[model samples]
Target: MGLRSALFAAQYDAAMRHAEHEELSSRRAALLSGLRGIVYDVGAGTGANLPYLPPSCRVTAVEPDPNMRKRLLARVGPANAVRVVDASAEALPANDASVDAVVFTLVLCSVPDQAAALAEAKRVLKPDGKLLFLEHVRDAGAHAAFQDMLRPVWSFAAQGCQLNRNTVAAISAAGFTVDERENFTVGPAWLPVNPMVRGRATPGG
Candidate 1:
């Protein structure tokens, strides 16, 4: 909410809207196919996932930026099925394990505290519920090193986005047993890390 954050917010929102859920069109269908009741979507900018979810499901979409929420309100109507709240990944304004499912697509890399965010996700998720995720993480080997080296500048420009976060390790450390993860280079190395990572995590019974 300070000067730097305010400026960061402006650019970050533009980057997000420019990308505009480009990665979700295909993966979202599969991820959202089995959902039933209450759902939480972390970093739910523009409420793009609003339509992919089931009709019966009630989405408590958490987004921190007021400006982004203002824009999101235009795209996603204020229906009973959707309730948008101003919140951040570090702290969720929800009861523990209250939601049936949680979706985090392309949000964690940009989160300031990935571990804390994941821990919060774990805390708020129901025992039987699933944490569905889709992230672009650091590649393995030399490319991974490049991701780390470039992160300083990348983060500055992208508003906290780190190019080098390992999706597998971070989620595991957060207590979310990974069900699946894949690595792919949609483009070149050096800049703009591209490793499409998708997986699921569940709380221990």
Candidate 2:
């Protein structure tokens, strides 16, 4: 693995400490509560959602980055029903209609193909399975323009995390019916990744 990747993984939690402690952690807890059965935590970076998930349910934490996977492994304990797997978002390891739920927390922005990843989520999910998602979307008006301007540089530095992705629209375009959603911002107002959305979706008929 390259030094940059290793460095990013090593310092991820530390870099996110302020945001998590101040805003995102409580949202994550509320969003992940009561989830049951076989759930997939897509792009499970350092297992951030591990603590919030229901222990009664099995969790398949999918992370493609080896460096991130190493840290994620350290977070899993005997008490937590979590399994760390080496896999990307576009290509999952589960069988079709096998997973009870799929989770995406601040991950869609970095996936090579957001549509394909969401498609895979739909493919692996049972007919009634739900998709729980929390993502920072494109901002409004002038902020969106600024995000576009910052996209190239920010994405390069942040390991391909796009500065402005319309994740909620992408989720709907993937044929999932958004059942519930709430829009809010996190971190400082100057941060580019503001105007986030957390929601639940079901496979559309």
Candidate 3:
């Protein structure tokens, strides 16, 4: 892995472990509950969402960062059927319309091209498949301005994570019709990246 990837992997779990709280756990379980067949989890950092997946689902985790993959492998429980692939969101290693569902959690911001990644997610999904996502997004007013101001520095330190990405809008632009959505703020009010969106989207209108 490259320097940025190494750095991100080193600090990722420590920085994000708090996200495994009860509320987020409930949300994750709910998101993965309906999914079945083959599922590709993009940016599966440390395999945080693995436990929440339904037992009926088979998972393929795509993670480009090697260090993160190491931890992810460690987290894969004995019973859960999981395969790991070295891949990025912009380019997934799966056949067209082959996957039953695509899962993304706190991953859209760090991708170099959110739209391209979303397009790839669409490409790998079955016609009736869903894309489930949980992401931090740009808020309005002063919070948004704060995100803009700190994004340059933050991205450099946080492995290309943009603090101000309007991910929901980007998802829509990538040809996925958002069938369900929930927007809310997490963490402290003072944090610019507190605003988050979680939901499921389907390919085409």
- Candidate 2, run of 10 with poorest lDDT: 74-83
Candidate number achieving the greatest TM-score relative to the actual structure: 2
TM-score attained by model 1: 0.85
Model 2 TM-score (2 dp): 0.96
lDDT by residue for model 2 (76-179), tens: 96656688889999999999999999999999999999999999999999999999999989988999999999999988888899979999889999999999
Q: For model 1, where is the 10-residue window of minimal lDDT?
A: 182-191
Best-fitting candidate, scored by lDDT: 2
What is residue 18's positional error in candidate 2, in angstroms? 1.1
TM-score of each: 0.85, 0.96, 0.93
Where in model 2 is the C-alpha error above 4 Å? Answer: none
lDDT of 1 by residue, 1-205 (tens): 3566566655655655534455445566767777988898888866667768888787888888776677667667755457888999989988998888888987898888888988888888888888888788878788787778888988877657778888768888888777755554443444466777767778662
Off by over 4 Å in 3: 1-4, 77-79
**Candidate 1: which stretches are off by over 4 Å?**
1-23, 187-191
Residue 34 C-alpha lDDT in model 3: 67
